[model samples]
Target: MNAAPPRVLTVAGSDSGGGAGIQADLKSMLANGVHGMSVLTAITAQNSLGVQGAWELPEEQVVAQFRSVVDDIGVDAVKTGMLASASMVRVVASLLRTLPADVPVVIDPVAVSKHGDKLLGADAMDAVRSEIVPLATVLTPNLTELGPVAGVELRGVDDRELAAKILLDAGASWVLVKGGHDEGPLSVDVLHGPGVREEFSSPRVDNRHTHGTGCTLASAIASYLARGYDVPAAVGAAKDYISGAVAAGFALGGGIGPVDHAWQFRDISHPGHPGRSKQE
Candidate 1:
């Protein structure tokens, strides 16, 4: 019998498009070498264009799914995406509190979709700040979400660290402020934590089909953490993985598509592919 691999759990919604929710998380975990499990919190009628409709699952169902996984299979790390309601956030946060203190929790503070669709319900941000943020081992929030989640309006790159500090003081052990939305030729992300502040930058891809980047990055971080990398190393590795995925993003429906979660496999199979190194 084969030994089990590192297990990472994703507590998130299901995207019918399979681009950016639990679907993306599982794909990223697989690419990063971990066994991924999920506790579905809601269902969305989503596609490459945008989310058409969404409905949060019952609270009991969410709790049951979580307990079924953590109590039996166990988890080395966890990643959270869209908890559609404030109640859902508290439920998941309460469940997370039951895990061993050592298990890393990567929180992707998702409030809006790539195509400008709102995902969180009223007062959900409050629940996230008061309950979830404090439990986070690493909080991954995009440029837009940073200010709102931390309750501050950022002026520019200069204020990113300040916003991150607010969340850090709120109790997240580490905070990664993503710069994917910044206007420039480079995509920059800042990871700040205890005695450490590091910047990761990659050339912005020219592709418009760059959906699922957040879910993928957060899951990749959790996967690496589950495989035993320290917080800094795990985040760095995730950045590299996401960079490749973003570069390989392809179009799906009429609107934006998704990042290639299997880009590493494609690189392995086709070493001579343009833009990818033979030794990658």
Candidate 2:
């Protein structure tokens, strides 16, 4: 008899291009050995080039999807992305509160795409900071979101520390200030809160095919958390996983491409955790 895989749920939008949003989240979950499930909050008409259009699901639909998954299938961890509006954020946040307090919730505060298209509306940024962020077990946000989240520009190592403290004071137990936007030889991610202050740095891979790094990293962290790793351990493992994915990214359309979610299976030379075995 086969044992059940650790289950992770993604509540996000659908990227028709299959490179980001729900597609990337589920792909990262599977790549990290989790049984992936999804509750799509929006759908986009998009491709490798860019997003042409997007439509948010009605509140009723979003609620129904969330219920359909958690009411029956259940979940070990949940990761949220592309919540298009304040109301949508509130709905998802409320539903997440229903889950047991122990179930880790990874919030990827996705604002813009690599092609510079807005995924989360400007008005919605307020919702993310006030309504959505407090529910975060692990809040992940890139520099673009720092101004709205902390009312300060997140730059330099000093700014990273200030911005982190502001968000921690707001609500999230842990804040992962993503440094992907920083121009430097090293991309450093800071995990800060409650007796934790560690930076995970990896040599920056010079590639434009990084369309889904945010979603993939957040989902990987959730997957590792479901596999029984502590918060610090989970973030560290996720950073390594995303670095490998970024290095292996391949061109898809005429525009930015995607991180190779299956890079682990493709490159066996790199060391990875055996206990978090690849899903067949």
Candidate 3:
């Protein structure tokens, strides 16, 4: 009999666009050779353009979904995205508290969508900080989210590192401050915690179809960690995976599309790209 694949569970919102949230998370996990599972916390009426509306699942339902999966299928690692309300955040945090301490939890403090649509409400910010953020094994927050989660404005690379440190102090074992919104020819992401800091640099791929980069990255990190990579190693592998996905991104639909989660398996028929064919 064949061994079962590594199991990865995503607790996040639903993106109707199928580019981010639970969709993207599961796609990333599968692409990285893990069996993916999800617990939907909210549902968004979203598309390529922006989010039109969002409805969070009731706290009881959310908890039941989580328990059903974790109690039976057994998640090797868990990744969390948008929790639309304070109550939802509190509920999810409480559930996390019940999990085994060694289970890796990758938290992507999703605040806004790729099109700048706010996914998290202001009223829920405090709850996120008090309940969710501290439970993360690694907290992945972009620049816009850094201020609220880390309680400081990040203006430069130095500021980003400082903010990551502060987030780690807040409770996360490690922090990855994504600098995708920063102004530079290169995108710089800093991972810092436990008195160790590592910087990852990649030339910015000028693509507007970069919708699910954050979700993909955090999920990839969780997937890799579930496969037994250390935090730094997991972050490094995920960074490389996202960079390649970004570089190979393609446009879809009418608005901003998503990164190709399966870029590593894409066919390269161009004559000059002989060795770049998709993997089976």
Candidate 4:
């Protein structure tokens, strides 16, 4: 019998729009050649415009789903997105504590959605900092999210490095400070941790369809790590993948759309290519 493929489990919310949250995570994982599983923490009545409503699952239900998956399928790596509530964050952190310490955990401290909708509540941020972020093998946070976790305003490249350092000090094994929200022609991300700091640079893809870039990037990192890449290598590969996805992003609704997680399978063109077909 053939061995099963690498299994990556995502503990996150659900996006009804088929764009972000569990939807994007699974898409990115499959696109990167991994089997995806999920423990839904919450569900959102969301669309391309914005999130109209959200309902977080009870802590007991979240725990049940997580235990069910890890007890059977056995995740090779785990990626966590929006925990939604303080109680949910606590539950997830406790579950992580019980898991084998060697398992790679990618935490995307998802505070808000691409359309500026609040996903993680204000009270939950503290739970995420104390419980979740510290448990992460790699913590992926964009500029805005980093501000609260790192307690530093990232205004430039140097500030981004400082923000990474602060997160590492906060107990994350490694930190990827995303610069996609920063102002510049070059989108830079810095990966820093114990005795390691590396920078990844890509020309800013001038596209607005970036609804789920954070979830996609974290999922890609977890998938790559499940395939045996080290933290740095996995992050590098993930950066490349997300950069391509962002460049090929397309508009869906009235607001921001999603990144093309399956860019590898589609014959999409680079940002400036005029003759490229938008259809899959």
Candidate 5:
């Protein structure tokens, strides 16, 4: 048999809609050529319209899942999203502390859903600041999330840079301030780290089915990192992947749809599936 692929673990909730959360993360990992594992923290009754209901898993169960995965399979990289409560945040932070120092951890502070439903509790923000931020190899926060986590109102690029600095000083190795929510022609993501700052800009795709963009981006970064790409390179590659996924997004339900995680394979034919044809 051949050697196993790079391993990536996602500690997050489950999206019943199969748009964001663990579903998106695993798809991204597979697309990036990594073995994806999951430790589910919560489950949401969600769809293209919105999140209807959410239930957090027991804290002990969450811990047990993490231990089982890390102790046996082991992880080359980890990405976190949609931790439901303060207690959950604390539990995940403690679990992360047990990992080997070399493993990269991408933290996507998922506080709200694409449809404006709350995922993380308001009470959990403090725990995220005190416990989770420090352990991040790369903290991925969008404009709305950045405001609360960094305690600043993001008005422009300058504000975003300052907020990123605040996160960098808060013990995160790097902070990616995403500009997808901003009203602009280009979707620019700013990466700020120890003596390193770079802007990665891509033309904003005109698609509206961007339900899982954050989860996809962060998971792709972890997948690339597991495959041995450095931080900046991993993020750049992830941006490219997300851009294509967004462009190829399709309508799934009555409301907004999801990005196509398999966008790169649109033109490729599998054993049982035929490739797309030209205009009929």
Candidate 6:
């Protein structure tokens, strides 16, 4: 058992463009040396530009998929992305409650896409805030998301802790207030746990090819947790991975691109020629 790789499960939507959502989550898990599983909540016709269309799966279908995995393969950690509606959110929350207490859970609380497309239904917001969020071991929300859920205007990095507190109050064991939306020299994330607070900072990569940063980061955190990192450690590791991915991001479509999930191997293996293929 010790020789096997950690297993991570992601409950989220599918990005047909293969840039974000479940696609990004699985890529992050693999990049971080973990096996990935998924229970799709919805499917979206998305590209680097934004989501064009989406449809949520039936609650029964979601439940069945979840059961198939947990009943057989099991998971070391779980991360959730887009739960399209209120009903889906409730079902997921209930399912997580049935899992073993030890397996950590990271909730990304995805509401909007990188291009500002609304991925979560307006009605589902309440269920996610109350029912689903409380079940999370760690709630990771970017500034755009934090502003609404925490109800505090985040002017800059200074107010991150306050936002984290608001999320913690809602029942998550810990809160990671993502500072990606802040205008700063560094991309910072504040991880606040019970009596524990820490900040993770990295050089904000200057790149427009950052389509799936949020989804990638949250799943990366869960991957680290599955590999046995404590909250702070997991977050730090995930930040580093995301930062590198961002730096390596390249144009994939007419619009924004996705972070390079395999950069660690690709860059290291081809040190002299980064972002170049044999044809180049």
lDDT of each: 0.93, 0.89, 0.88, 0.89, 0.92, 0.88
**Candidate 2 global TM-score:** 0.93
Compose the digit string of candidate 5's lDDT tens values, residues 1-280: 9999999999999999999999999999999999999999999999999999999999999999999999999999999999989999999999999999999999999999999999989899889988999999999999989988887888777888888998888899999988899878999998998899998998887779899999999999999999999999999999999887887788899998998899887654422112232222
RMSD (Å) of each candidate, 1 decimal: 1.9, 4.2, 2.6, 2.7, 3.0, 3.1
Worst 10 residues of 5 by lDDT: 271-280
Best by lDDT: 1
What is the lDDT, from 0 to 100, of the residue 169 in candidate 3?
Answer: 75
Q: How far in Å is the alpha carbon of 216 misplaced in model 6?
A: 0.8
Runs off by more than 4 Å, candidate 6:
1-3, 153-159, 267-280
Candidate 6 on 1-280: residue-level lDDT in tens? Answer: 4677998999999999998999999999999999999999999999988899999999999999999999999999999999988889999999999999999999999999999999888888778888977888999988888876666787766677777887788889999988888777998888899999898998776788888899999999999999989889999999988988888888888999888888878745453223454436
Write down the RMSD of candidate 4 (Cα, Å): 2.7
- Residue-level lDDT of model 1, residues 202-246, one tens digit each, is 988788988999999999999999999999999999999999898
Which pairs of residues have clashing backbones in candidate 6? none
**Per-residue lDDT of model 2, residues 39-116, tens digit only:** 999999988999999999998998999899899989999999999888898899889989998899999888888788
Q: TM-scores of all models?
A: 0.96, 0.93, 0.94, 0.93, 0.95, 0.93
Candidate achieving higher TM-score, 3 or 6 = 3
| Residues 143-231, model 4: lDDT tens digits | 88997777777666677778777778778999988889987789999889889878899989779988899999999999999999999
Off by over 4 Å in 2: 267-280
Better of 4 and 5 by TM-score: 5
Q: Candidate 2, residue 78: CA error in Å?
A: 0.5
TM-score computed on alpha carbons, candidate 5: 0.95
Lowest lDDT block of 10, candidate 6: 270-279
